[model samples]
Target chain A: MLGDIKTVAQGTFDRYFKMKELYVILILCILNIAALSRYDVLTLNMGKEFMIDGALAILTVVALITSMAVIFEKSRELREKTAHFIITKPYGRSSYIWGKFIGISFLAIFNMAILTAGALIVFKLTSYENVMANNLATEFIYAALLITAEAIVLTALGLFFSMFLSDTITALMVLVFFILGHSFYILEKMSSESSKIFGWVSDILPNLHNLDLKSAITDNITITQDVLGYGLLYAVLYAVAFVAASSMIFSRKDIS
Target chain B: MYAIETHNLYKTFGWFLSKRKVHALNNLELKVPENVIYGFLGPNGAGKTTTIKILLGLVIPSKGHSKIFGIDTHDPDTRNHVGFLPENPKFYPYLTASDFLDFCGKIIHMDAMERSKRKDELLEKVGLTHAANQKMEGFSRGMLQRMGIAQALISDPDLIILDEPITGLDPMGRADIKRILLELREEGKTIFFSSHILSDVERMCDMVGIINHGQLIEHGSLDELRSDIGVNIHTTGVASNALMEGEKLCDYITLKNGEAIFTLTNKSDKDTVMKFISDNGGSVIRSVKLQEELEAFFLRRIQNDEKAREEEVN
Candidate 1:
């Protein structure tokens, strides 16, 4: 069973990298970096703030697109019966679901790492002041980690949606979840006086806003290790729940 | 123990929509002994594929149960000894043939060394060694079918279940698959396959089950079914309708070139027909029961089914 999981995860990750969409998303990330560099130059040294924001924006968009593509590709495989080769083997359905979850999560982290390097390169070549090089590097790295953590959570949600829903609807729902999750704080505040259901909804949805480290760079606030650790734990927990739900549904699916 | 067994296996689909059900497999009872090729024959939508799916645990039976090697199919371990090739197999298009086989080996928990060795052997057996490095996206249908067979054998499973394994192959391709299946049978592997190519089934299958309308219509050893078709008496020396009229047991008579061929209506008439032919100055040229060809039997079964269905409809 462990071997089965490793094979599926490795196979899925390898296949994900081979996709043409990954390269397209990489090129788009590079173009976004170029645009950010141009904006930094036009502002005549804006002090590393917009550059971090630009980097996070690029990471979020690329992560969401790639995650959706990966999940949809897998969903299509199941519907098209290409999965017959794997599902008919000795492995359990849970292994297949977990393999896909881990595989796409790996891709999510890898994609963010590549774009983080690109964003760092962009910031290095561009002019910025009011912050030391080490400080900027540290801040940029934490921001990348936060973005990746959130992306991991969203990827799990996308995979869960893909199991029972069509690709278009799954993509749309994941997008909606991302947007709503980012505004979870605002929903919590507005619903404080409204109904108890709204409060539950806010708590149930992933608090993606908590993982956003961009404001730390802009507001000159230091993000402690404890806060980052908490955010990572939250992401991990949500991802686990979503994957468990997906595996439960997939294990019993007729798939005919 | 039987290699494959099903007790009153039943499957129904689309039960929620319009309150109608499509009975794919209805009260199917099957038993296949070990180390023999069992050919499953049926027309389109005759539940052959559905039965295979149930055995593979792809679809659960609505009622009854199936077992592989005496182990319930619901257990994942039961599939460890079974290899299945679905009809018109669809594999991941991006992986090369070797990589795909490696994945299959991994699915069955084979170690790297054993996987590599088994992969090479199966690739050779399926005539896919030359295209071992070629991606499946460019493969022709025949090549994909061959690759499907190779992947199915990657685990070296004891029980092989194939659904329409020879659908889209040239004569040479068909011959290659037939050879592989026979060789596997020789190795004491249990091989069960469904095919529209009755000639291949006739030549390769040790036992066969004919299914119609989601029911087993006829099943037994090939020779047993063949021998049930009755006897034909070919006589020389005189061509006459007198043999048919005199024998009172001959159902039909055909005369050509100073020879008469009589189809006896009953097995009991064989001795009487022979005696009468000898007594009437006719020499029995060849007298033997004609074995029913698979094609003929299949067509007759299907025609009978259609007639019965029509009568009920009327």
Candidate 2:
């Protein structure tokens, strides 16, 4: 397991290094988000302006991009026929599924990490009294935890779609899932306001809105322990189901 | 005992609407004796690849069974002992030949020393030592194929399955692969491969199976195939009326004017017939057995079937 993890980590880091487009967009957004602090409009209440509004947008975009990373990976692997090399060994199916998930998941985290780091650097540079005085440690940890859950669910969803779909369909469907996955909160809200059928639909829908905890980080709002625990549990359960499902589907697949 | 066996193997693809179920292997039966270079011959859509795929466990047999080394193919152990190379071999383009082999070694879970020793040995055998470190992305078709062979042989498997191993090779490349296959055979490995090059099969194979239209029309040793070319002889310098209408020679020999032609189906019977003709009052003329080229023999069989279908329709 350690060897597998190491191999996956190396492969992921190597891939992240090469995916210039990803790094470029992510860095640009981090800088863009940091620069938004220049506007007093966003600084009125750090909670409402920076964390709630600004961080919500970042989490949504990151979730969407990370989900699509599944397609990026599947296209490269399927098109190049790398599966033949990977599929013929011990733990081949699981290694391929999880290795890819972690690879892209780590990349997604790195993107978010850069933003958080950038936010800290801006605080250091600007030395805003509240930004400097307020302890970012707790809120940063909360933000990290929320992003991790979001990354897990998105990665699972991505892997599920990638397992059976061809390169093109995998990419397209992941895009669809990303858009739909991130908007699950709205879907659920809309469904609840509609009919009983909608209620049932919302019940099945994963509440991604719960994953958005940027307000707590930016505005220094305290996150309830139960709420955090529920979101964590939901992400874990969803990830486990999807990964298990992908394993079953891929196990029977003919690599030739 | 045979190293590989298949009974009534049938596979169909596609379903419903466009339902173009290619009965890729229609009740195809095969038995490959252990420790021989078994050349599987076929044209396009002849189900050669399909049979190989089924044997390699890359496919599900719709209604039949196959075994390798006396073990059922669906058994995981069977795959562990068998090595395969698909037609149009595809590998990770980013990986060099050595890295690819290393990856494959890791996949099959070979111990470090064993994988390295085997990798070096296979690279040398395939003559890819100079290019081992070069990325496969720019390798020629023949190079890719050679690396593919090397990859398959990494585990030093009991049975090696190659689909069209030498199809798109220059003379030298073909010779190299044939040499390697021969060497592997010398090492007591069972090599089963398909090829359109009938001559290659004729030269390399101890046993050959020809599949066409999802059916195994013929299979046996090359000598058996040559014999099955079936008794056609044309000759000149024969005395007139050498063949009597009701004679055993009549059944075996065809007379063309003054010339007596007899295909030697059985060598011993050829002498007996000649003696009978001489004793029966007709002079024996020149007689020789003819050998049909494998290609000609294949074309004739396929053509005859077409003719039979046409006549049936009429």
Candidate 3:
């Protein structure tokens, strides 16, 4: 049984080693860098932003997108009528679902790492924003720690959604929730001056904006320790909660 | 112990709106012995696929029980020795031929090197080595079906379950598939396949089960069932009026167009029946018994079933 699970895990990860999906991540990174280059704000302190800001945040978003893509596309055979080939294999159904989840997550992490290097290259080529380069580098490096935490939460949520829904609906629903998650930052700010109910709603929604430090990269800002710690705690809590829920749903759900 | 057995295997689905229960396999009882190709024959919607699904543990049997090699089908370990090719097999369109087999090997827990070696061997056996590097998206129907067979054998399973393994193949492709199935049978694999192609089944199967309306109408060795439903003895060239008069009033005789024909109650009685016609004013111009072809036998069974239904309706 241990061997069975390991083989499944290894095969699942090996699927992501495909060159086609890897190209998608590379294309996304080049596009991201090109978009960032268009902003003069990013040009102002490119090196400082690298030394002091979060590079992995962009990757976290991209990784989430890819994770959701693999969930819908790569692992869809489980629900199809012709999946009997895989379903008939030894202990197949659970292995496929979990294997696909792990494989997609591994690919996402690798994509994040690649994009981080892309960000680094941009910082190195531009000399105008050389101030606080060391700080920016430290900030970006720290971003890895935080964004990975964010990724766990995102992947867990994606897996949770995959449990009860078809691939298309799950992907669409995740995309919608992603938009909603980003808008919650505006709601969080409004909670300070507006109605108490509005503040309560903001509190209820996952504050995914904390995972994004793009403004800091462009404007040479640093997140406070208190905010970082709170965001880290929220990320951890959300990851644990969602992963637990995902496993429970996955255990009960019939992919076959 | 039986090589494969099913005790009242049934699969049911509940339609949400109408709340109707669809029993795909209704109390299906099956037994397949070792080292024999079992042909599962049925018209569309006869639950042939459903029974195969239960055998491979792809679907949960809603009622009754299914076992493979004496192990419960629901048990994961039971599938370790089994392989399957589903109807209209869907493969990963993006993976190259070798890569797909490697993937199958991995699921069966073969190490990478062994997986690679086995992949090549199975590919060669299925006649897919030349197209080994080609992605399946560009493969023709025959190619896809061949690839499906290769993947099914990647693990070198002891039991190979194929559902309509030859639905869309050219004569050569069909011959190739038939050869592979025969080879597997020679290697002592229990080759259980469902096919509408009775010729393939007739030429390949050692034993066969004919199913209709979610029921097993007949199950036995081909020779056994053939002799049971046996062929219609076509007696030809009898003198018209003499043959008619001779056949008439003979309670078991049937006449058609200048020939007297009837099924023998036993093989030993064929000569006796022919002798009767010759003795009674009619000369047995050409005496012969029907050489049972599986297709014709099955069609006759189907027509008989239809007529029975019509009579009941009237």
Candidate 4:
């Protein structure tokens, strides 16, 4: 079973790299981050902070789009009956889903690393006094890790929705969840003021705030190791729940 | 145990919201023995593909059950020795032919050394050695079909199931597939395939099952199903009046260029026709037994089944 998962993961990873659009998006995002850091166009005299923020935002978008592309390709495989080749093999459906999650998550991490490197290069070449004096390097790395966690969770959510929904519908659901997940605090407040159902909604929705370290980094609030650890744990638990549900649903599906 | 067996397998499509339910398979009972090429024949939407899907555990049977090598199909291990090529097989577009085969090899738990050896052997066998590194998206339909066959054999499985394996091939390609299948049979591998090409099936299949309207209309060996339907007698040189007497004993009689031909629906009538021709001073040239062609037999069985269903409805 582990061998099958590895095969599937390797296949998915190779296929994604072959996609020209993924590289196109990656290059565009890197250039955007570089331009933001070199020129203070977004905010005057605070180009370094703006670059970091813009880079993280761009990473989130890139992760969402890339993950959506994977889901859409998966939908095409199901629609075109290409998945029959893998599903009919001597492996369980859970292995296939896990392999897909791992493959896409690896791609997400790679994308984040490239973008982070591009941002750091621009920071060094420009020799931003504030960036060097404030020692924001560690915080930037922590923020990037947080974004990676969010990207992985979103990939899992996309995979779960894609089990029964079309690609378009799955993307819509993932986008909605992404929005609701970030606003989980507001939902919690509403539950105290009004209907108790909002409490359930907040509980059901993944708390993206747990994985959001951008504000802390930007506002100069200290993000300790324990917070980062808890965030990673939350991401893993949420992603696993989604992956387990996807596997259960996929195992029972009629792939005709 | 049979290599593949389905007992009272049933499947239906649509639900309460739909006005009608499409019964894809109704009590389909099939038994395919090991080490033989069994051809599954049916018209479009006649449940041939559905049955194959069920055997591969792609589709759950609404009722009844299916087993592979005496183990339930729901068990993933049942497919360990089963290789399948779906109709119009599709693969990861970005994967090369060799890479795709390697991935399949890994799925069956073949180590790197065994996978590499088996991958090369299969690529050469399927005539895709030249396209080993080429991406599958650029391949023609015939090339994809060959790749499909290669992947199905990468595991050196005991049972190979293919759906419409020869649909997109040229004559030479079809002949190559026939040769491969025959060679596999010689190695004691059970092959079950469905195809519209009855001529190829007739040449290769040791046994066949004909299905119509989700039911098995005919099932037996090719020779048994194509049993001798009649006999033909050829003779000459007696006079047109003598031909008339011989014609009375036969169901069909034709004369061209002073030679008379008689076709009898019963093999027993051949002796009587020969005796009559000889008594009338005509010499018998030859007698040949006429057997049904597989194509004709398949069509006749399906037509009879349709007629029976119509009568029942009426």
> Evaluated with DockQ, which candidate comes out highest?
4
How would you encode candidate 3's per-residue C-alpha lDDT over B1-314 as one tens digit per residue? 66689898777766446568776787788899999999999899888987887777656677788888999887878887888888776777778999888877866778889998998898889888899999988998788888888888887788988989898888888888899999999999999999999998999999998877677778898777774533345566555556544443333556778666655544345565566656654555544444578988788777777687699999
TM-scores for all candidates: the values are 0.87, 0.77, 0.76, 0.89
Fraction of native contacts (fnat) of each candidate: 0.75, 0.22, 0.53, 0.80
* Candidate 2 lDDT tens digits, A1-256: 4455446545655656665787787677767666666666556645324533564467556756775776676556655555544544345556667677777777767766776676556555653545545455446546666776787777777678776676567767766655565566665655544465654454345556667676555556767777778778877887778878886777666553
Candidate number 3, chain A TM-score: 0.71
Every candidate's CA RMSD: 4.2, 7.2, 6.3, 3.6
Error of 1 at B43 (Å): 3.0
In terms of lDDT, the poorest run of 10 residues in model 3 chain B is B243-252
Mind sharing the TM-score for model 3? 0.76
TM-score of 1: 0.87
Q: A98 in model 3: Cα distance from truth in Å?
A: 1.8
Q: Model 3: how far is A216 from its true place, Å?
A: 6.4
Q: What is the TM-score of chain A alone in each candidate?
A: 0.88, 0.77, 0.71, 0.90
Encode model 1's per-residue lDDT on B1-314: one tens digit a residue: 99999998888987556577899998998999999999999999999989998898888888998999999998878888888788877788899999999888887878899999999999998888999999999998878888877887877889999989999889877888898899999989999999999999999999999888788888889887764667777888643646656556577767767778878755556777777777777887886776778899889878988899899999
Chain B TM-score of candidate number 3: 0.78
TM-score of each model's chain B: 0.81, 0.78, 0.78, 0.84
- Ordered from best to worst lDDT, the candidate numbers read 4, 1, 2, 3
Better of 3 and 4 by DockQ: 4
Worst 10 residues of 2 chain B by lDDT: B242-251
Candidate 4 docks at the CAPRI level of medium
Q: Per-residue error at A67 for model 2, in Å?
A: 3.0
Q: How many collisions between residues are there in candidate 4?
A: 0
Per-residue alpha-carbon lDDT of model 3 for A1-256, expressed as tens digits?
3455455556555656665767776776656664554455665635344333334546666766775755564345654444456657766665555555556566666776677667767666655355325476556645654565566556666777777677777878777766787678787677655376665675456667776665654575775666567777887677557656665555444334
Predicted structure 2, TM vs. truth: 0.77
